[model samples]
Each structure stands twice: as structure tokens, then as C-alpha cells.
Target: MNTTHLTLDEKRTLDYLESVKTRLSQLQESIHFFLRSINPETTPGTVAWTELHSKFNVLIAKYLHLTNILNDPRIAFNPRNYTVFPFEPPANDQQVQNLSVLLRTKLFPELEQADEERIKEGTIPGLPALPPSPAPNRAVNPAGVNTPVGTADEKKQWNAYKLKVMMHDELCRKADGIFEQQRDMVHTKVRYESDDGDEEDD
Candidate 1:
């Protein structure tokens, strides 16, 4: 894609998405640290739980808003085809996935509920259908395994290219090895046959 020709709106969208990703990472890190610091022996009271829950809800709302914005089909990264902008991988894959799960399970339904309320109130013009909400992850993984973050499809494409190259190299090496082995076998058989013929002649 010709990333150089990106429009102002596209650039702004990308920037906004990047900022959201950064904030999500920070929020996840904070939550993890807080959970780690707490002791199970001193069980969290209702008030403490409520406070944590509220904070989590706020984070999830923001995450869902940003994620939905990014998920707009118009903004997706495409190589040499759809998008004029290049895709970049986000720093925090685990955080993104966790945020995605939180959005899908809790935040998305809440948003839909809000949208229904808006429609009832006659605030928004039309009920623009959102992308189908995904199912939540049963358990989130810890930071940084191989889980893809922002522009995951782009990463997949790049990975596919790399895999193809690796496979080609492997096949070439294997073919060369096999050819050498066949050549050696043929040479050995020929030499043995020649010697046997010579012995017979003698």
C-alpha cells in the first residue's frame, strides 16, 4: 500500500488507535500490579471490590470504544490493495487481547444497551449496526507470548511470507541432500559392478 498518501482523517484514526493501545497497556499493567500486591488472606471488602469494579468498567468502556472504532472495515490495513497506510504492531498483545475479551463480554453489550436507549430517546439518527461481537476469552494470558495485537492481520500476512520463504529454503536443502545421497549410492553401485566385471574377465 502507498502509505505516503494517507489522508488526514486516516492518520488521525491511526494515531487515536495507537493512543488507545498505549492506554490499554497501562491499564492492564496497573490492574495486574494491583491484583499481585493484594493478599488473599485479607479478602477484599465490598467497598474495595466496588472501587476496583468501577475502575475496571471505565477501562473496559474506553477500550471497547477504541476497539470498535478500529474494527471499522474502512480502517483496516491491507497490503498493496485496500489501505493507503501501513500497519504497525502494538507493543502490548496480551493487553489488547484482554481488552478485546472484556469488550466482547461486558462492554459491548453495555454499549448496545446504551445505543438502544439512544434510539428510544431519538438522539442518534440511525441505528448503525456494529460488527458482530466476539466471544470472550475464558482466561487471559500473561504479557507477551505470540498473541497478535493491533493490525494483527498484517502481522499474519508478514508471517505467512516468512513461513513461505523458510519452507522454500528447507525444501531446497532437503532436495540437495537427497540428490547427493542418490549420487553416492549410484557411484558405489557402479564401482562395485565394474570391479565384479573386471574380476570375471580375469
Candidate 2:
């Protein structure tokens, strides 16, 4: 919005930011789906499972592409310089790294668990098989190994968490839409005023 004033590099950075946001929304949807549907009994090779896995793989690739773009020295993309959203600080490098790790280490392993046969085969069309599970001693959570959602309490908690996350995402999207509309209106007003001044001069 009102990006006409931004330089070429800044505009490209903003575009990259938008791409990152869209990819992140997709990643969140995949995570939510896995949380809601994936269990110990989830059948592999099914349409839903296959499609989600493929989509997840695509999301991962797109995320990596975005990361590389941002990391390019020529781009020098700094999120802090462009404040698209009010009050929310741009994500720092640590936050981006944490997200990358969560997707790779946590989410990828969970996906592999859903289809052990495919994983064992070392490849699945769009997705690659993950390595063997880490040694128990080296696990991120040694005290609590990863397991499918089983207990009624666990299911309830997951559902609650998902609901909260979805609600927050919805609110943020709505706010962004409103902000965009306002920015567009302001831009249009400025353009009209400029036109009127030119007409007066003529």
C-alpha cells in the first residue's frame, strides 16, 4: 500500500515479505491438519494424506527459497525498515531460524511417522524420507518422546490450541485487510489532490 514511494530494492523486499507471509499461512494450515487428523491409525497412500504431504513439501521448498532470497547480500532485506503491520515487530533472524528448525526437526519427523513404509523406501514422490529417529539420549525432549495424539485429554488440548490459533490467524487477516483498504483510500485521495493541483496550474 502506497508503495509508489518505495525504492526498487525496498519494493522487492516487501514482495518477499508478502510471499513469506503467504507461505507461512500455508504451513500453518498443514500443521493444523496434521494436528487434527494424523493419528497412529492414519492410513498412508490415501488421497488426503498424499495431497497434504505434497503440499507440505512444496511449502518447505518455498520457505527455503524465501530464506535464500532474504539472505542474499544484494537484497539486504531488513524487515524493521518496512512496518506493514502496526505494533508487531518484524521477525528477527533467531525467530526465522527457530521456525525453520520447528518445521524440519519437529514437523517433518511427525510426517514421516505417519507413513513409515514410504519413509523406509527413502522417497515419496514430492517428499523425501527423513532419517532414522534420533537416539533417545539426543532427542529434543528426552523426557517425552514424540507420540500420536491418543489420550482424550491430549486430544482436547490439541483441539483447544488449534481453535485458538485459527481464531488469532483469522483476526490478523481481517486486520490486514482493513489496513490495506485504508491505505488504498489514502493513496487515492492524495492522487486526486495532486491531479486537482495540476488542473489549477494549467
Worst 10 residues of 2 by lDDT: 81-90
Lowest lDDT 10-residue stretch of candidate 1:
79-88
Among these predictions, the greatest TM-score belongs to 2
> Over the stretch 1-202, how does candidate 1's per-residue lDDT look in tens digits?
3557889878865676466557665666565545543545233433376766776776677667656665666755421121111112233556345322222233345655665455335354322212221322201111222543336554464344334334444544554675577679768966996788789799
Q: Looking at candidate 1, what is the lDDT of residue 61? A: 73
TM-score of each: 0.27, 0.30
lDDT of 2 by residue, 1-202 (tens): 7999999987987787787677666655566555435443333344586766876776677667667755666756554322111111224546434322222232345544545556346344422333344453221222243342456654454444334334444545665685577679768966996788789799
Score candidate 1 by lDDT.
Answer: 0.47
Clashing pairs in 2: none
